[model samples]
Target: MDDSTIRLALERHWAASDAGDFTAEHDIYAEGAVLDYPQSGERIRGRANIRQSRLVQPNTKRFKVRRIIGTGDLWVTEYVLTYDGAPSYTVSIMEFRDGLVVYETQYFADPFVPAPSRADLVERPGTEAP
Candidate 1:
């Protein structure tokens, strides 16, 4: 698929996710797509299985996309997933075939407080440095 097409597909996917619309979110996956959650050691094969797995999740979640970057058939999206008011940073790497996602691996991370020693080197989002 062309760059613009892939980008639009990704945007639509994320938008569906943010809206908590599982059907629309999973529509971009191919029938035999594979999804991997490396952190959880889980591999969900087939688009149907992936959709079912997400449908059973109990958390009330939302996605805030930070960035989406790639070319050709490989793409990576970084986003913050908020579940029950707790945010988890996530990265999803996808490989597409014929404009549909065929293989994907996702990683999730919890937020951590900034270390005191590095306070001068980094800036926090809302607080002003003293």
Candidate 2:
């Protein structure tokens, strides 16, 4: 698939996720897809299993996409995933084959305050720094 096509698919997937539509959310994955969560040391193989893993989660989730960038077979998305109203900054890397995701790995990090020493050098999200 071309970059634009893959980008559209990703947009649809994220939209479905925010809407809690499990079937649509997993549609971008191949039948033998694999999903990895390195922090939790877990790997979910197969589209059904991946969909099932998220299906059981109880938290109300919302996805705010920051950006999606890549070409050909590797794509990366940076987004903020809110669970029960708390935001977790997340990065998802997807490897595709034949226009379907064959492997994906997600990394999540909870928000933290910036160090006091570097306050002058840092700029918060969604703001311009001079």
Candidate 3:
């Protein structure tokens, strides 16, 4: 698919998630699509199962898209997912075929404080220099 089309699809997916519309968010997948959570080591096969799994989630979730970079049938979306008021950095890599997502893997990481040892070597962005 073209870049614009892929971007639109991703926008729709994020919008749906932000609105708590699970069905619309899950509709981007094909019938036999696979969704993997690498952090949890869980593989959810089939779009129906994936939808069902999300339906059982207990936390109040919100998504803020940070960046989307992709070409052809492969795309990566970086976003912050806030669950119960705690933000988690997330990356989702999706492989699409025939205009539908066929395979996807997602990674989640919680925010952490910078290591003191790296303070001298690293410059933090969006912060005033000390």
Candidate with maximal lDDT? 2
**Model 1 TM-score (2 dp):** 0.94
Residue 130, model 1, lDDT:
61
lDDT of each: 0.95, 0.96, 0.93
Put down candidate 3 lDDT per residue, 14-82, tens digits, no spaces. Answer: 999988999999989999999999778999999999999988999999999999999999999999999
TM-score of 3: 0.92
Candidate 2 vs 3: which has more lDDT: 2
Worst 10 residues of 3 by lDDT: 121-130
User: What tens digits encode model 2's per-residue C-alpha lDDT throughout 30-86?
Assistant: 999999999999999999999999999989999999999999999999999999999
Number of clashing residue pairs, candidate 3: 0
The predicted structure with the larger TM-score, 1 or 3, is: 1
Instruction: For candidate 3, give the lDDT of residue 58.
Output: 96
Q: Single out the weakest 10-residue window by summed lDDT for candidate 2.
A: 121-130
lDDT of 2 at 5: 98
Pairwise lDDT winner, candidates 1 and 3: 1
